[model samples]
Target: MKLSVSDSDLLGLVHLIRLYGKNLSKTWSYTITHLIRKIHDQEHFPVTDMVKKELNADSLNKYQRQKLNRRLENDSLMIEHMIAVQSIINVIMKFQYSKNDNDAIRELRSILEANTNCIIKFAIKEKDLKGI
Candidate 1:
């Protein structure tokens, strides 16, 4: 499957790669390089957000608010969870799709992806995987 990114979003990714190259994987670096080369090849294809277009704010009622308050008060458990997620990712990332990386990636991606207007999405072709 092919994915297209906007000049605005592409510039954002370029900025992130510039600031955090050490944290990014080779697959990401290689893909971003390709994206940069293909920037001029862009078409005006409108991309949609990967999230629900509308959210029901009515769900945030009294009970939900109370539960949220309790969760915020539970610092020890949250800290332990953070530590576990940190260990899950490792000092240097080995693989981004392993079981150990799942929870860490899920939580971080949940927040970031949820907030993204439109994200750059891609699948590494099998032939290119080994090289990355």
Candidate 2:
């Protein structure tokens, strides 16, 4: 399947988080929150308030929020990611899927890995997954 540079970059950013970024405090803080929400929303499971704090955009600072919003706005890849991720979330939330389910995730991982160079960078400096 073909992907635009922006889409590839967004996927790479996600992959970077799954790899190096997964262990970082910030990554866990943010990703887990997003993950939980995705999982809950997709799986129809309930998440605690504490978990919500992690992914909540309102919890982010002005700069971080601005950066994230810009990244989402400017990147077509990110938009695609949102579409795909949300679909995954919807399936999971409906109880038709589970977190242990790997089909969609694996497929996405493969696609992103295949296009690593195009899939990971954002205009923001901190969003850059190069060193990590």
Candidate 3:
């Protein structure tokens, strides 16, 4: 689906990535985790609390199971948004960490732009234009 991300959301993401890059001493895993948490924290979905409860449950009642399943579908869709952004960042980081290869940088830039567009498309697909 063609998702359309808002200008603010796009700028926010770019700013976040740049901020994270300032701390180059951090590992990629740590940076990605922080980014994911930041993204997840910025949005509030009513079903999120229930989903968390269901996740922690030892056994789900029929109603809870059904509700959790429905909510999870939405959650998974949002997760795709996160994954798309993370993937793009990962590619960009790889380029940054690599030897200065113009060819590699060009290839990575193409991939990053494509993935960034995908994230924007996913954002547009969301019921509310609030990005991931």
**lDDT score at residue 25, model 1, on the 0-100 scale:** 71
For 1-132, candidate 3 gives per-residue lDDT tens digits of 212333444444444445566565557556655654454334332333333454654333334444555765444323324335556566655544333344444444354445532121121234454334
Candidate closest to the true structure, highest TM-score = 3
Winner by lDDT between candidate 3 and candidate 1: 3
| Local accuracy by lDDT, each model | 0.33, 0.35, 0.43
Comparing 1 and 3 on TM-score, the stronger one: 3
How much is the lDDT of residue 26 in candidate 3? Answer: 57
Q: Of the candidates numbered 2 and 3, which has the greater lDDT value?
A: 3
* Residue-pair clash count for candidate 1: 0
Q: Candidate 1 on 15-109: residue-level lDDT in tens?
A: 44445556777677566545433431342212112111222222232244334446543221000111222232232233233233345444334
Each candidate's number of clashing pairs is: 0, 13, 2
Q: After TM-score superposition, what is the CA distance of residue 100 in candidate 3 from its true location, in Å? A: 23
Q: Per-residue CA lDDT of candidate 2, range 2-116, in tens?
A: 3222434344445544544424566454563475333222211122233234334222322343455564643311111222443443333232212332443455444433322
TM-score (C-alpha, index-matched) for candidate 2: 0.21
Candidate 2 vs candidate 3, TM-score winner: 3
